[model samples]
Target: MKIKLKSGIDGLLFGMREKDVKELYGNPSRSYKDDEDNTIYLYNDKKLRLTFYADEGFRLGYIIASHPDTELSGTKIIGQEWPALEAQLQQNGLKAFEHETFDSVDNYFNEDNWTIFQVEFGTVVRVEVGAIINAKDEFDWKFK
Candidate 1:
């Protein structure tokens, strides 16, 4: 699937409702609440994990796509070496990542758009993208 920067992969925008997501991808293989008490829909077959935050009007707030299958600008993002992947991302107009590592895993964060590439053993394992709109104190949204 193609990555759309701050937007979502494919047509799954950042501010989409759970009902809308269900309509598009059908029922998830498994459904449960995450540590944060948000609802998580896991589509194992599609290698996708979508999180809907109850506080954000239950809109789709987080998306986690697994390795090898997810592509960015036609380039497969997972399983590539860190330096090569970083250069490729820069060539695609995404640049200047702040890398954080713990144990054997590395996370490259682009604060520019909240796109995170989680790498392990020098290869990317997953990609996460999401948005949290603070447009209003309550009952309002401005997608970022």
Candidate 2:
């Protein structure tokens, strides 16, 4: 069965403590400590780093995920040449839904991380991200 959960800090109330989120998601590939020393989590990759920003109250500002999987036909994948990847694709091949039809070679996002690409694919194909439900009111923020 598929389940959805809120993404922002409000979602953190569903038994998802800060430590738990870290443990499940793994140490952010990198982290940034604000002027106040509040830590913002980051998942770093060659092309993208999923970042989590926190406000004074620890509420998530937003989630920005980018993809760099699409590549130019003549360019190199990590400096190895695009032809090599294409050749490999033809050999190993990807899943049916993992492919995209790029109208032009210039329409690709160049980055080192492929996680964002996978996320984009999932979203474009109706795959879901963390969900938000049972929204917490100001009163909900109070944890005695």
Candidate 3:
């Protein structure tokens, strides 16, 4: 589930909490405040920034995932459980994705034999991809 997102300065302006911002992003390399009482978190390497107000609701004033001055990279999905993830994506009406097959699908799966399926969501978007077990496995499971 790896996908790239659009980056714009206006995309940064929003109302959200500092903790919520932290939860969405891992952590900030630096933090500061402004005259308007907005708390700012900056993650330079990731090209992300979040600003929140101190008042109740901690209104998120701005969020700059990537500056207009730079190019942004897609999000990476690693250490994810592929099978369940694929199902979840399907459930989300993400059928917008297209599918592709690997030439040696079975070999990459580390299985005795396998069939692979992949779903693509536009360009550089999160897609669901997985493998299928043959009738033999299904038969064995039914018997068990």
- Model 3: how far residue 31 lies from native, Å: 0.6
Order of the predicted models by TM-score, top scorer first: 1, 3, 2
Q: Write candidate 3's Cα lDDT for 1-144 as tens digits.
A: 122121112223244456655676657899998787768788786655555656534655334432323322231332224455445545743334334444522111212212122222312212111122346752111111
The per-prediction CA RMSD against the true structure, in angstroms, equals 2.7, 12.3, 17.8
lDDT of 1 by residue, 21-96 (tens): 8898899999999787889989888789998897776788789998467898888887888789899889978887
10 residues in a row with least lDDT, candidate 3: 106-115
Q: Which pairs clash (backbone N, Cα, C closer than 3 Å) in model 2?
A: 5-131, 6-131, 6-132, 46-112, 46-113, 47-112, 47-113
lDDT of 1 at 128: 95
Give the lDDT of residue 31 in candidate 2.
66
Q: What is residue 128's positional error in candidate 3, in angstroms?
A: 31
Q: 28-126, model 2: which lDDT tens digit per residue?
A: 767676676545566554222222334424433223333233232322233333344445534643212234444432122212112112222222211
Candidate 2 off by > 4 Å: 1-17, 35-38, 45-61, 68-144
lDDT of 1 at 80: 82
* Candidate 3 displacement at residue 111 in angstroms: 55
> How close is every model to the real structure, measured as TM-score?
0.88, 0.31, 0.35
Ranking by lDDT: 1, 3, 2
Query: Which ten-residue region of model 1 has the weakest summed lDDT?
Result: 135-144
Most accurate candidate by lDDT:
1
